[model samples]
Target: MQKLHKLLRMGDLAAFVGIVDDGGFAEAARRRGMSASTLSRSVTRLEEQLKVTLLRRTTRSIEITSEGAAVLAEAREILNRSETLKEIATSGQAPAGPLRVNAPVPFVLHVLAPRLAEFHANYPAIQLSIDMTDTLVDLIGSHADVAIRLGRLQDSEMLHRPIGRTAWKLVAAPDYLDRKGWPEALADLARLEQVRFAAPDHINTLRFIGMADPLEIPASVTANNGEAVRQLVLRGLGVARFSDFMIADDIRAGRLVELFSGQLDAEPLEISALYLTRVSGLRRLGVFLDWLDAIQVG
Candidate 1:
């Protein structure tokens, strides 16, 4: 409205967005084919108009102020909507420039992070910006090109393509299993050591194939994150369960052992690659989704 116009007047929204997204006036200017001083002035004008500081200046890094972070998210949303409008007006065209993606932390760390080199090598023109978190992201609100979602999905405007699936892999480091021994049966958990995160719902107990009841396993140590749990297992702490996606590499490398040799069922998890529209897919988004679909784990 009037205040928004006042806040963003004169300077293009793209300038401020470029500065925030690239993390500095210099990088933004470099990318936009403009001088750093120009982008600096653009940001300064924006701050003056908005009456708030957006960034903390330093030689090493430019940190976003709290207000700046909030505004940055909004600015990305605005830019995204503007892009969508332009695409609709012209018909969806060839994709270029940055392609923002959001995915769970574990997926990013284990699956996406390791293979990023291949992605870049294949599609060097598409700049990949990744947001790694377990939380679900609103595609339009976050201005993300795509999102990798796991488990049951709710009805939404976004189109989801089934990308991959993960099943439970009860894993332990070779040394740990050798020393502490593996949980031979579901009932053996009362005496075996286990590592788990504090996620009450996921690790409250272990569910097995053809088991009517969930078995509550006592944990030797509880960490706060999936990576932590994975690390503890690698460090020979205890036998713990992981989604095959999270422990695939380790299991492949013989760093960890999948416990259920012939006892468990492979109930793979349904993972989807989500995007806003299907009628006219962005070329880069389609390319990335195909690349993602080929990722092997469990």
Candidate 2:
């Protein structure tokens, strides 16, 4: 055990990582300006220490074994943490670390996609890892730095900062309306073919403004992705309630027509940036939240 402990040193692990990253011993050695024989030996030592075969080698090419692939993932995380630690120590004023974010698919597709370049330009030092999904995730349990959520949130220990809201737009393709006829009221929505977005967390519900009760309707088709739902809507498949931001271009282009504008305001789709209580104190989180708060959702 002690021998194994001595062999799994940071330097040896780093050397092992380089081998996998560069794809082969000779290439990694060339990049690092080290002897190929030295790197090969380091990997050999790592394999022995772990008591697993990490590589399959012949005269010409080598492939990583299953065990090697597993270790490679862990090694990369270690290296990333090491890099973050070094950056944090050297650059105190600049927020430099991996910022893992989770956000709804609709927001990611319509809102965040266009402004990512600007965000990167502003925070070039901070590494962003954005996970797009509609399903609700535990921010603390998932080790995510921030989660951009829409609609109401259940009481939780995480800190929430209001960012923006999504204004719901009831819309359909012009062709669809011509074929199925325009929905004059919320009651008419049920008669038209509906493009449904079903996810574990998203309720099959739409609440309009000035309506006493939310409309409950069954959908003709279901889709998991917001982009897919938009496409489905554009194809004249059915009428679907969409965030105004997602359909703004279509509406302006005369491709889609908004219906029931005077009849309903969607139950507030409040957008907020949720983060762990512990992470709220971190400057990296603060920097990201500040940026989020400044976002003007069009």
Model 2: weakest 10-residue lDDT segment is: 1-10
Candidate that scores best on lDDT: 2
What does candidate 1's lDDT look like per residue over 1-298, in tens digits?
2245445843556787777667678877886798988888878887887788888889767888988877776675665556656556644444456788988789889888889999898878778998876666687545577888877689655688888778777778988767766666667766667887776356435667788776666678988777888898899878777777888778889998887654555456778888874425356777787787787544
> CA shift at 25, candidate 2, in angstroms?
25
Give per-residue CA lDDT, model 2, range 1-298, as digits (tens): 2233344777777888777666678887896799989888888888887999988987766798888888877775665565556655765567766788999777887788888898889888789888887777776434467888877778655678888776778788989888877776678887787788766324346677767777766576888877788899899888878777789888999998888775555554788888753343466777778887777764
Local lDDT at 283 for model 2 = 60
Ten contiguous residues with the weakest lDDT in model 1: 1-10
Model 2: residue 204 alpha-carbon error in angstroms: 4.1
- What are the runs in model 2 whose C-alpha is more than 4 Å off? 1-92, 183-191, 200-218, 277-280
Q: What TM-score quantifies how close candidate 2 is to the native fold?
A: 0.64
